[model samples]
Target chain A: MESLFTWNFASEIVLSTFRMATPLLLVALAELYSERAGLVNIGLDGIMSFGALAGFMISYLTGNPFLGILAGALGGVLVNMVYAFCTVTLCAEQTVYGMALNIFAPAISAFIYRVYFGVSSTLAQATLMKTIAIPVLKDIPFIGPLLFNQTPMVYFAYLMVPFTAVFFNRTKAGLSYKSVGEYPKAAETLGINVVRQKYVACIICGLLAGIGGAYLTTCYVNTYSDGIVAGRGFIALSAVIFGHWTGSGVLMACLLFGFCDALQLKLQIISKDTPYQLFQMIPYVCTLAALAIMGAKKAGPKAKGKPYLREER
Target chain B: MKLGGKSENIIIPLIAVILAFLIGGVIIAALGSNPVDAVGYLVQGAFGSKTNIGATLVKVTPLIFTGLCACFAYRCGVFNLGGEGQFIMGAVTAVWVTVSWGLEGPLACAAALLLGAVAGGIWGAIPGILKVFRGLNEMIVSIMLNYVATLFMGWVYTELLRDGSVPQTFPVPDASKLGRLMPGMRATWGLVIAVLIAAGIYYFLFNTSKGFQLRAVGLNATASRYQGFNVKRYMLFSFIVSGAIAGLGGAIELVGTQFRLMSGFALGFGFDGVAIALIAQLNPLATVLVAYFFAVLRTGATTMQVGSGVPTSVIDIIQALVIIFAVAGMAFVRLPGFKQRMLNRQRGKKEE
Candidate 1:
């Protein structure tokens, strides 16, 4: 046990934690925005799956990872428009429609992928995004290597943390978004276009989730596999609740989830005797525990999961 | 002319199915296949022969159980997304009892199924207890439990209950296996049992006072609480009972069809059940019909793929579209203008 907790091993785990957490952080942030605007988008996993395929295909074709990321985000927005239409414009059940997309998008994505690239023994690879190191910052003692040296996507995810904090707390648009979620009728009466805000929130959520999905294919790994997105999208959903819908809280929650993910992978490698499936269960178990402990008291927006209609008395 | 509530409930989903099929045809055409030929193959595959019908019915059996599971829970306003987890736990427990314990005879089948339901109920109660007592979100907790259950199942098969040479549990005893409706057919009496359960659920939801209170809780929890209904208890009851249904389905699938527990056992059935329940408007009888419809699509998908060279995933796309269109159309029908227009039409007809 003492040998297992060596400095090198601990540092490796921490570094991997950041890498693992990047997608979760991005998707959780995306979910935070949608939920804040009273739109519960459970289709994050589906969007991510589509994004992964789009990102992989585009990067494979264009030989440009950034273009693939862009395509992924745009593809996400395109798919999310269906959700926006059903939930925002039509005022349908948010969870049901979101789940519909969750079922729909993945099938379409797989269909497209199979059409473009026939089944083969060898996995089609994409150009992975290269890690970028800040020059002087990398030379700094402990924190430098821990934080400064990482992929551009990882840096961007962390950068959004503060941006989101300020956007929700300080900005006028953010407050309006919050108002729409809290009380759509009141927000509408106050001259805010509640429908438009909800649409925008869905778009933002889709785009970020797409990027998170793309990161798995184009940045984290160089190839795409079926079910690559797995349940990270759902974990991100949990992170939103576990974080109490705050930006920093979500970051902390995502990091903890990422740690569990990384630890599980490491433990799988370290212990050959124990079934790998037991280790694989760690992240989900932790998420459940965290939600049970932290998600009980604080509730989300008042108008969440309800269809807001302007004409209804 | 104004349509009755019962007819409207049926018509909207019917229209959605037609619309989805039309769109699916267009997609198949774009994929360079003859849409007409694909449809022919789909029909032929699902109902081609006695064997094909039996296979389709076998698929429908579990779907009916899972669909009814979702329908029951949703009727109580509880989203028990843990149906898949409950199903897996049920299968695991049944396999353990049937094979590991070496249970024998007809009693073994009955005992295995009951134990499976109990296991599923316990697995489902976790999220319910948390939601009622601790105010945790049931949906997320239930979904998380799915992953845990799946991993646990994996561990059981690969580590604990693994049989000779393969990573799967031992097959159930021959005597414990469910009897078929017809000789040499794969379809078991499970289909009959599932249909009966659906009828039982329909009666419970529409007939009993307790069921009425459950629906009241689902419709408006606060109002139900005001009316002296224990809303929390209803929600928890829905979760447990719903879970038991799914678990029973899992056991039925195990003994009735899949005698050996393996990887990918009962994957996607839970979500499929959710979609079926929603598409059926949460009506138990309608759930059985919708489950059958989904099974038809699934059973036909392989044939369509083989004949037309289109991927079987096109069926999945079609299924998703049906859910989307049905949900969106139902919402549209519920709009004030539409409802008001129907009322006005009926009133004008009476005056004439």
Candidate 2:
């Protein structure tokens, strides 16, 4: 008597889930890349904020969302340079530098919003990233649009997941990067440019994480706000850890968490009497639970916070 | 090379603080603010009157707890990134205790402080235990728990503690509050508590067997394990203790400053504590000086904003810059043959 699959609501949930997962995928993959090289990106969250603001600002100024995305990525790299400076050069606590940068990003952006942008809601009519129809794929009925006919950036991000895995697993430098993470001392003895490799991974993280923030602002929300990044960098960090530093693993974790996030939002509309706050917290709570119950697989970097040094050179 | 240890560590931070402010002065000038007037305003705003000094002291109150929170785990070779969560839970637990029964003066204060630490310790231990038992990462655990604690705190405020008359919790009974220490300022006995906690942590960490175990673990976990020390147990203990210190910090803030539980009462102190701890290089005594300097910058920043056309956010920028400069070259003393390894890595990359 029951219809096999309701066309009305369930599909909408799936679509929203995919949409939500996109940014997380981009950012987590970014983390996977950088962390694999033994350098950590704590300011991924801050980079997201800076990207959102930069993307929104650029889109607003030029009336082009594509340009906005580029601007956003560049902005992220710019902010991350500060992180790279303290973490890589100064040999500071990566997490401490990261947390400070996170706090600093919002404060600076909020001030700029007040000072430069003033109190206007939404860069009102700033360009927004829209789905592009794949000519052949667009005509392939329902599943086509959901899968193929999506924003260019989303497709790019999805492609990046596997692309990154191949890069790390196949490329010569990628092997060196992994070696840098596992045994910096041995890798150094073998004459690998450990610090340079570390910088490369970190800078790439900056760019990809910037795109992730750009996706949130230009694609998902179409504007920026104070809590714009909203712990997504941390979420990306969680996804990377949950997936145990693998490319495909991070994608799966991102989708699962993002699905939970979308599902929690839908749960509130299921009935009137349910305590929505409890449901709202399910995604994060799930992240906490998953982090705890995921077992030995989620162990982190070997020489995580320690700076690589050579003989008293 | 043979300079006294304490003097150099302490003096380096002082110089860094001075240098950071000097840079901040340039930033103020760039923002079109007069440096002298801005400095004057900041000094007056943060410590000018009795009321201002009192507020500065109150603000400095929680920093001491967070300082201990960061320093404790850091000393043990495990970084406790969950200070914010611990602080929040401590404040929340304090509120619940105040509501349930009426305990006055020293007992109420003592109870609140202990419960605060316990709550923080437990919160902190979650990550530490995960790190030790399941082989799960502590950084991820601590990071996620922070959001959980914050949201949970927000929920408790909205659901259970909300006075219904306002968006925040109802005030604690007069007896639950630590009495004010000054006539003109809101500073209370909380400052004294903060001081005592810092001093106690310093004495315990630098002078005791427990401190040596933690330092040994931090210096080399494998070596400590070789020495038959339970690295995991101490990591858990110190992390929990650190969380407790931070938790007690949140309770003090509630009792001394806010007098009621509010969402985000602990604010950015937990994160700021990391900066303080780093600047102090995990030295317990150095934490006091760093906390005070940060407190002055924060308290005076508002005045800087008002007096100069510059935004107070320049303080945050300066804070970041300070961390960059502070941790510089700490790796200078690492390993017996660090340079040879560094050069090899560089050469390997070049050949590839």
**Superposed Cα deviation of residue A63, candidate 2 (Å):** 2.8
Off by over 4 Å in 2: A1-6, A89-93, A118-125, A139-142, A183-192, A298-306, B1-8, B100-109, B329-352
Looking at candidate 1, what is the lDDT of residue A98? 78
User: What are the runs in model 1 whose C-alpha is more than 4 Å off?
Assistant: B1-4, B341-352
Interface CA root-mean-square deviation for model 1: 1.1
lDDT of 2: 0.78
Q: iRMS values in order, in angstroms? A: 1.1, 3.1
Query: Which digits, one per residue and each the tens of the lDDT, describe model 1 over residues B1-352?
Result: 3444677788889999999999999999998999999999999899999988988999999999889988999999988888899998888888888887767978899888999999889888999998998888788888889989999999988889889889988889999988899896799998999999999999999999999999999999999999999999999999999999999898889988999888899989889999999999999999999999999999998998889887888899999999999999988888877778888988988899
Give the clashing residue pairs of candidate 1, or none: none
Q: Model 1 over residues A106-164: C-alpha lDDT tens digits?
A: 88888888878875547888899988999999888877898888989999999999999
How accurate locally, in lDDT, is each candidate? 0.90, 0.78
Model 2, B196-307: lDDT tens digits are 8788888887799988888999899999999999998998888888888888888888777787776557767777888788888897777887888788888898877777
